[model samples]
Target chain A: MRSSLILCTATRFLLPIILMFSFFILLRGHNEPGGGFIGGLVAASAFALYAISHGVTYAQQLLKVNPINLIASGLIIALSSGLFAVFNGSNFMQGYWSEFKFPVIGKIGTPLIFDIGVYFLVLGIALLIIFSLAEEEEEIQ
Target chain B: MNLIVLPVILPLLFAVIMLFAWKYISLQRILNLVGSLILLIVSVLLFTTVLSDGVQSLHLGNWKAPFGIVFAADILSSVMVLISSIIAFTTALYSFSTIDNERESFGYYPLLNTLIMGINGAFLTGDVFNLYVWFEVMLISSFVLLVLGGTRNQLEGGIKYFTLNLISSAFFLAAVGLLYGLTGTLNMADLSEKIKLAGDNGLITVISIFFLISFGIKSAVFPLYFWLPSSYHTPPSPVSAIFAGLLTKVGVYSLIRMFTLVFTVNSEFLTNIILIVAVFTMVTGVFGAASQNEIRKILSFHIISQIGYMIMGLGLYSVLGIAGAVFYLIHHIIVKTNLFFIGGLIQKLQGTYELKKLGGLYKVYPIIGLLFLIPALSLAGIPPLSGFWAKFLIVKAGLELQEILVVVISLFVSLLTLFSMTKIWNEVFWKPAPKDNPEISFKHFTLSKKIMIFSPIVFLAILTVIIGFSVEEVFQIANQSANELLNPINYINKVLGRF
Candidate 1:
């Protein structure tokens, strides 16, 4: 559980940058290769790095929300995305698009929302497993 | 709008909500109860709709068949869904009394709903790959449910259950990959027609056997049934009841569905293999049950034995045989689940599940004895009960098919089942209490707790009696479902709109 000062200092700068990049990946996932699953992994790895630099306790405090809630919310979002189509008299999981398109990300749709849900879920699951393992490691040490 | 999706989605929705409300034990309980009740109503609605309108299929995202995932509810699918919902509702009610507060607060309701959702999805989906997805959903939730308490016994059982099921899933996935590679379609209806056109018997048979092995493990047939008795007795009573009732049946349902719809080319060969497997499954299961002294363990073996009867009907490959299978399936789900629930109640009241350690229930609580007798006799295929009609149908079908050997074995198995049930009755209910033991009284339980537990058992026993008495009505439905299964054209036409 030893932490180097340089690593801790470096993590302070790296954390937000990595999170922003993960969001970027998720936002562009509809058209690009980077989607929620990969983005969530990236986000989770950034937190894992932070936990290594700081400690599991500090990293959990930084998370603010419980990982299980994040997972639950993500599932709700994903389910509702499909449900949107059903409410619109379309088939389940059918994507509906708006005419106004953003420059970086394409037109807003259910698929992107669905991807975001995946992002949260993957992030939550990854973090939960990592944190639990790290805590176990600490206990053993 | 396709109501077919409701039975699947409603549980998912309920699971998600319960997940969010995980901390509120009372709220979670009420929500689960309400959710399962609503699911029962929705399944009934779906059943009636299918009955009046014929087979129903919903293409997700409005994609055409052979391309998009479809949820189809034929008579068979609706019947299975309806029965599963009934089990879901009863289990939810049963849990109120048996499940501890720790398990409740630890996400039991959500997991249970997810399992139901998976079961419904498996029954309703028209796509093979989607069926795999549903199976995973069901398995994942079930894995957690099996090991939820994290007890030594549970973990031990969970590891074996997990390993074997993972292997089964791998086989299932491999089969799907090969089938898709061969036929270029994942839609089951599409696969039916395309497989016929593929016209290569040798490879198709190979793929079919791969599927048979995969599903055989899940359904707990013959040699593959070792995991069932080892793991099922480890879980809590309600969990074991649901597992005994619905989980293996999903595999049996898949076996019946695939063998009937998609694997007709090698009927003679497959029939021989299936009949052999069926006979062995029956004999071995009953023998295993007879040797068990524990209540749940005995019931677990009985579940395996009864599965053989269903498979036998399928091997018969006639309308009556299939009808018999369907009837046996519906009857078994009710009887097996009730038996487990009664087992749980016995454990609760007497504080032991070991036959050698328990006795005198009939002397103290004749009501309990009566309640247990209904399902016990039903499970033993006693006359004028639901199981008798079920056994009669299958035995008659076998006779008509001139499958005298299977019929004889099946009847012998029935006798063995009776012997075991009577053994339970004699040991647990009839015999006097041991010298060191005192008589346990139901007066100790609160009225509400007693009501919560007994109501489901009473309700299911009544259902068994109703189905037993109204055999004509139930058989007609089973026959109709059997006819639909026999002719895949109706399913294909409904799903693919080939007309």
Candidate 2:
């Protein structure tokens, strides 16, 4: 898109902050209103902003693993989290809680892990689509 | 974990595994075969368990029924899953020989496994919203499979297939929303009980129509079937065969499930509408097949015609009728998939699907011709074959109901179906090969490739014959499945944990 210098610099500055906010949203999802889906969208938009200002290749470099790999790993993590219940003698996707709490994170649970998996999945899929579209546009140019 | 959820989970797990093994095509094939074999074993085990234990229902996350996602497998769901696994196993085997490396490299195996997972999930889900989610999963994977090659024909077909399906999904979602608004439940069993209490409201009838339109498009019944013929023949043979075999049947299964389990059948108006739709669907589908020259297209239109027979069983809404529909569904999946596989072999040999350009198969490859005949005759309702039994039950049900006009139309449709089969037999097999046609010698194909192609066809054809000869056993299962449908008490009690 070749935006103006101010917009490009602004995007570069805001990207990390946006990604951190997305992680915050994901972490609060299990008990609060924000969840993995919305969190992932926020993160994807940050990267999308970077791709637009800098170029897709730079965005690709930042994403060391392919989006497909991210998607697969995310799904595996999510599915295995569900299987934790089976090993614990509960039904599939049954949530198990541990007493340990880390800093401000409260109780650790399988559902939270599931939510994190969803976060990565949604982020990867969104970037995959956006980046492909951006690259195709670049090729046309 | 309970075995009830294995059919859905195993395929999903394999799909993810295949994604990681994407760079290794041979390894992916090995994984696909092993996964499919394991799925078949799981499905058969589940079916046996259902047979012995009655319906099995599991609540995900240990949440109680009507609140949590429930996976319930009754005789009907178990049998459907078993047949689906069988077809998937065969399709996996056939794809080894038929699907090109380009498509394989593009994640075909993963998508296929994901599609199986979707089908299993759809078959077993007890919640309406969960069914919608599974449909989306199935549809997305199917959309990818349809256009994997990126050929012009494939993309064109993909557009029509996906767009219409998306519309159907929207209709399905809207109907789910309205039903929830009225009854305050999305669970099938709970909805069944509540809808009964709600009585024969005109709004309920409208809701039924919404469901009818939505599922009708999916099953390609009657006037809403334009997208099927245009799209089904575009994919690679194995992809098309699996689509031909499983996809529409899922729609029909949903129709049977919703109408039989959820909706009250007190309205004669609804039954009459379905009856009319069934007759017209049969007539139109067979007529469409008669006009087609391409092998897969002919088989594609025949799929629509065969669907009418299944819907007729539902329209009858009798014990025998539903049983007949169930039997027809099982028979059609095996026969239709085998026919498509044979068509693929024909295409491979002759390098064309057009009837005018294909010939001399009977002389050159008698075994292939015989393979073709089994499904062809069975599809035409010849005696001692699966199709004949399927038709007999439906026709007998019609006669018992004294639906003379529909019986006549059904009989005439069978005759017409036979006519089209003969057309294929004559043009593709009986006629002499045209001069200048390159003879496709069997010498060109490696023995393993030949085995890969032939084994699935032989296995499915043998299944059709076994089902035909052992009609009593198959019919008994269908009858029991039908009885379960006719009475949903067990299904409801199990899912709701009322027992």
Query: Candidate 1 DockQ score?
Result: 0.71
lDDT of 2 by residue, A1-141 (tens): 477899789997899999999999998888888878899899999989888888999988977788887788888989989999888788999888898888887898998888888988898899999999999999998
lDDT of 2 by residue, B1-499 (tens): 3788889999999998888886889999989999999999999999999998899999999899899899999998999999999999999999989999999999999999999999999999999999999999999999999999899999999999989999999899999999999999999999999998887788898889999999999999998999999999999999999999999999999999999998864648888899999999999999999999999999999999999999999999899999999999999999999999999999999888989888888888899989999999999999999999999999999999999999999999999999999999999899998776758676658999999999999999999999999999999999999999989999999999997
lDDT of 1 by residue, B1-499 (tens): 5588999889988988887787888999999999999999999999999889899888888888989998899999999999999999999999999998888888999999999999999999999999999999999999999999899999999999999999999999999999989989989998888998988568899899999999999999998989999999998899999999999999999999999999998799999999999999999999999999999999999999999999999999999999999999999999999999999999988888899989988888889999999999998999899999999999999999899999999999999999999999999989998766665877667889899999999999999999999999999999999999998788999899677
Best by TM-score: 1
C-alpha lDDT of residue A137 in model 1: 93
lDDT assessment of candidate 2: 0.93
Error of 1 at B162 (Å): 1.5
Q: Model 2: how far is B304 from its true place, Å?
A: 0.8
lDDT of 1 by residue, A1-141 (tens): 678999999999999999999999998787778999999999999999999998999999999988888898989999889999888888888888889978867699989889989999999999999999999999999
**Model 1 collision count:** 0
Which of the CAPRI classes, incorrect, acceptable, medium or high, describes model 2? medium
